[model samples]
Target: MAFDSGTVSFRRYAVMGRSPREPSEKMLQTLEGMSFAPGGSGASQEVEYGWSGGRHVLDTSFSFEHNVFGEALHFALRVDTNRVPAQIRRAYQIIEDEAASLGNAAGKKGVKHAVQRRIEADLRSGRYRRSRLMPVLWDLPRAMVYAAVSPAAQEYLLNLFERTFELRLEPLSAGRLALRRMEAAGNRRSYEDAHPTRFAGGPDGEERAPEYPWVPRGDYPRDWLGNEFLVWLWHHTETEGGVVATGRGELGVVIDELLEMHCAFGETGRDVFRASGPTRMPEAVDALFSGKVPRRIGLIVESGGSQWQLTLSAESFACAGVRLPPAEQAVSPRAVFEQRIDALRDLCETIDALYEAFLKVRFAGAWDAHVAAVRRWIARAARRQGA
Candidate 1:
C-alpha cells in the first residue's frame, strides 16, 4: 500500500532547548527533574512524569512526549506485549489493546488546549522526553486502528492522557482505569452500530458467498490468535528467493534495492530542506546479486544456484526523509532494513511535527487519501501475503 507512509528516517534526538520554546527557567528545571539517572543493570533511566510522585505502576506505560513543533506535549499510554499472556488470547475477546487517543479529539469535555496545558504537570514531575524511552517498537496493529480513527480522536486521547496520568497517579493502575474508559466507549459504540442489516446476493447471482471470503465460519480477524503475518512472510520468502527471510524474526519485508538506497541516503539527514525522491536500487540489486554477491553468471550453465536476479535500476524503493550514516561507518544490507523501521517512526514524528499542515490535510481532507491507502494495503498484503 502507498500507506508505507514514506519510510521516514529515525532522526536522533538532542536536548538542546528549554521547554521547547520561550526557554523558561521553570521549564528547564522541570525538564531536568523529569530525566532519569543511569541505574541497575541498564543505563540511567529517567523518572516518568505521571507516576513521578505516585505509588502505582501498571502493566502498561504512560508517557508524556515533547512534540517537536514545541507547541505542546503529546501524552500517551500503551500496553506491553509481554504481559499479554498466551492463555488470555483464547480466554478473552482481545489479547491486547494499545492505542494512544489524542486529548483534542472532538466531543471531549475540555476547552481546546486545556489538555495540552495539563501535560506540563508531567514536566515538573520529572517525566521528560527520555522518560517514555526511544526506539521502542510500537504496536503496529493498534497504530493502524488509530490511523482509522479521526484526528480529533487522536487529540482527545492526548488530553485524557494528561489527566489520567497526573503526577500523583500510579502508572500501572492508571492504565487499567484508562482502559475502563476505553471499554465503556466501545460498548456504547458497539450498540449504536448494531442496527440490523442484510446483504443481497451479487448482481450475477451465480452463488452466494460470504462478505469476507478469506474468513471461515465463526472466525474473526483475531490477530493474537494467529501469526498469520509471519506465516505469509515465510511462504513469500520461500517463493521469492530474492527477498530472503531474516534469521531472527520477520519484522518486515525488505527489498534488496532499499538496502542500496539506504546506503545512498545515509549521509544526508542533517539537511532540513533536503529533497525527497525515489531510489535507483533495483539496478543496484541486480549488480549485487549477479556481479558482487555472485562471481559469474553464464546463461548456458546449469541454470541453477540461488537463481535470484533483482531487477536492475528497477527503482522500487520510494523514500522521504531518508538519512544515511556517515560513509565512515560501514553500512550493510541489514542496516538498511533496520533504518527502514526508524524511517517510518520518523515519518510518524514528522506527521506530528507538521501537525498544522496535516490539519490542512483534514480540509482537502485525508478521507480520500485514507480510503485509497486502505484499499492499497489490503490489495498489496493479499497479493504478497503468501506469494
Candidate 2:
C-alpha cells in the first residue's frame, strides 16, 4: 500500500440559493484558526479579499463553463505540487483538512466502499497507498459556489477544498472515467473494483458487482468510441430499430457536447447521466425501449398550466426499469429507468385490458358523475345493446 500515484483529484460540493454573502468576521476567524492564510504582502498578495490565497483558478480561468444539477454551483481544483511555495504550509494544512472533511461528508456509511473509505482517510492524511503528489506544483485560489444536489449527494463540501488551498480541480466525467481512474489509481487500478457496477468492458460489458446497489446503468457504449465502433452500434440499434437521430442532425451535434459527460463526471467527481435534450422527442420506441444510449431525456420543460420556470435537468434520469432494491445488487441508472418504463408499459397494457372489459359491459357509476338522466339511460341501453 505504498503511495505511488499522480495528482489527486479532490472535490467539495455545496448548495445555496443565496448569492455569495460577505464572509463574516467569525467565518474569517474560523478559517484563520484553521490555518487558511489570507493573501500575503508577498508576490501573491491582494488588496481586497486578501483573505483569498493563491488565485490560480481565477487567473487560469475567467467565467469557466458552469454546469449544475438540483441546486449546486460546481467548480474544480488541481493541487499542482510542482508549484507549491515554501510559505504555504498553512495552505496545505487547510487542503488536507478540507479533503478529510469531504471523505467524511457522508459519515461512516458515507463512503461507497471500505477501500474507498481507507483511501479517503489516507488521502486526507497525504498517505497515498501507492505514490505521493508530484513535487513542484503550485496551487491557486478557487471558489466554492453554493449548490444543492441529491440522490447520490456526492457533490457535498467542494467549496471547503477550494477556499482552503488555492488549487484547480474537477471531477471525472462518465466516459472519461477510465482515463481519470487510470491516472489516479495508476498501478493500483484494481482499487476501483470497489465500484458496485463497472461500465468498462466488451462493446458494452457493464458492472456485474451488485454489492453497491445504488449504482445506475451508464450510457457509454460498452467499449466503443471511435467511428467503426459507432458504426457497429448504429447497425446493432438498427437491428432493434433504426437508430434514433434528429431530423436536422441537431442530435449529432448535441451528442458530441453530451459526450463530455465523461469529463464532467470526472471533474465533478460525480456520475452524471449524459442526457438528451427534449428539444425534439424521440422518433422511435427502440431508442428509449432499449433504455440504452441516447437516453430518453428532456432538456427543460414547461410545467403545469403555464409558467416560465423550467422542469428539465441536465442529468440522466430513467423513469422506468427493474430497480436494485436496497437488499438486492446494484444496477445502473439506465436499468432503473428501463425498469420504470417497462412497468409503465405494463401498466398501460393492464389499463388497455380493463378498458376492453368496460367496453363490453356497463358497470354501475361508469358514466360521468354529472350525466343527465336521459343521457345516462341511453348510455346504459347502448351498453346493454353492445353499442
Candidate 3:
C-alpha cells in the first residue's frame, strides 16, 4: 500500500512570494491549536506540525515528522480510514431507525435529507469520523509537496494550508506543466491540438481493442501534451537505441516492460491500450496507429553504471515506484535519503531535457515529417503481421 511504501507519490506546486525563514511561532501555535483527530475515538490523535532535520526545541511530540531540504518542508499527510466500515454500518442503522419512526410523515426524500443532516451533525460533533494521521511529505526547494491521501482529503488539505499560511496554493497540473515547458523552450506556438492522429482498424477485429487497455479506474482528465511526450519519446527510443545526448550528460532512457496508451480523441469505449515488453510490441504499435498516446510508462535511466527505475505519469511527470541503485557499503539513513533525492533530481532534469528536445522538433516544422515517418513504420509493421 502507498501508506507504507517508501516510494514517494505527490502533487507538485510552486511556492510564490517570500516564505518566512521558518514556520513562525504563531504558525506553529496555529498548527498545534488546529490539531485534529484523523478519526474520532480510537484513532483520534492530534497531529501538530514541527520543523524536522534541523536544530530545534521540542514543544510536544510531533505525530508526523517533517523534513527540511533547504527552505522546503517535507512531510507526509496521511489519513487512515480503516475504521470507516463500522462507522458506515452505525450510520446506516441510525438512518433506518429514524426512517421507521418518521413513517409516511417524512417521505423517502425527506428521510434521506434527515439522515444526511444527522450524519453531518454527528461528524461535526465528533461522534462518527474516520481520518487517521498520515503526514504528506513536502519539499520546499522545488516548491513541491507530496500528499498520499484521497482526492477529497487533498482538497481539504489545500484549504487548511491556505488558512494556515495565508498564501494561495496552485496545484501543479498538466496545463501548468505544459506552459512552463513551452516558455522555457521559447516555443511560442500553441499546442492546443498541435497534432492529432486517427486510426483505421483492421478486419481481424483485434484492432478494435481499446487504445489503452490498462487505464486505472478513475475519471482523471486527459493529459494530451504528456501523452504526446510519451509517444515522441517512444519513437526516439525505438530509433535511437534508448540513448539521447543531453547538455548535462548522456541520458539513457529505456521504456522497460510496461506501457499504457490513451487516445484522447478516439471513439468512446475504444480509448485504451496496454502492453508489456522490452520494446514496443505489435499490439502497442497498433494502438498508436489507432491514434493512442502514452499515459504512464515504466522507465529506466542510466548514467554510466548508476541507474534509476520509476513509473512516470506523462502529464504530471510525477515519479512513483522508484527503485534506486544499490546503496554504497554502510551509510546512515540520512545519507541514503539525500542520495535518493539527488538521483530523483537528476531523473527530473533528464526528462526536462528530453521534453525540451521534443518541443524543438515539434515547433520547428518537423512534426509533419515525423508523423509521416511514424505512419510508414506502422504500415510496415502491419504488413509484416499479414505476411
Top TM-score hit: 3
TM-score of each: 0.20, 0.22, 0.71
What is the lDDT, from 0 to 100, of the residue 371 in candidate 1?
A: 33
* Poorly placed runs, candidate 2 (over 4 Å): 1-23, 32-284, 293-298, 301-387
User: Who wins the lDDT comparison?
Assistant: 3
Q: For each candidate, what is the lDDT?
A: 0.25, 0.26, 0.56
Writing each residue's lDDT as its tens digit, candidate 2 over 1-387 gives 000111111212222233233333343343343332222223332111211121332322212122111122122222211222334544545555565577744444442344344434533443321211111111111223212122233322234435544333343222232333334535233323323222222122233311211223454311211211222222323332422232211111121112111211122122233435221223222121112222222211111111111111112211112111121231754343333323323322232232222222211243233123323333343354443
lDDT of 1 by residue, 277-376 (tens): 1112233222221211111111100011211112111011112333322222327533443444443443333322222222222223353564354334
Question: Candidate 3 on 1-387: residue-level lDDT in tens?
Answer: 121236655555555555455534454455555444333254333322322222223222233233543343444343433322456757765766676676843566666766666555555455543433434444545655555445456666676666756755666554466666666656535644343333334333344533333333234332455666677778778888888776656788888757866554444223333444534576676666655667778888887677877787777666667776655652766556556556555666676777667766766667778867766766776677557
Residue 129, model 2: Cα distance from true site in angstroms:
21
Worst 10-residue lDDT window for candidate 3 reads: 47-56
Candidate order by TM-score, decreasing, is: 3, 2, 1
What's the TM for model 3? 0.71
Q: What ranking of all candidate models by lDDT puts the best one first?
A: 3, 2, 1
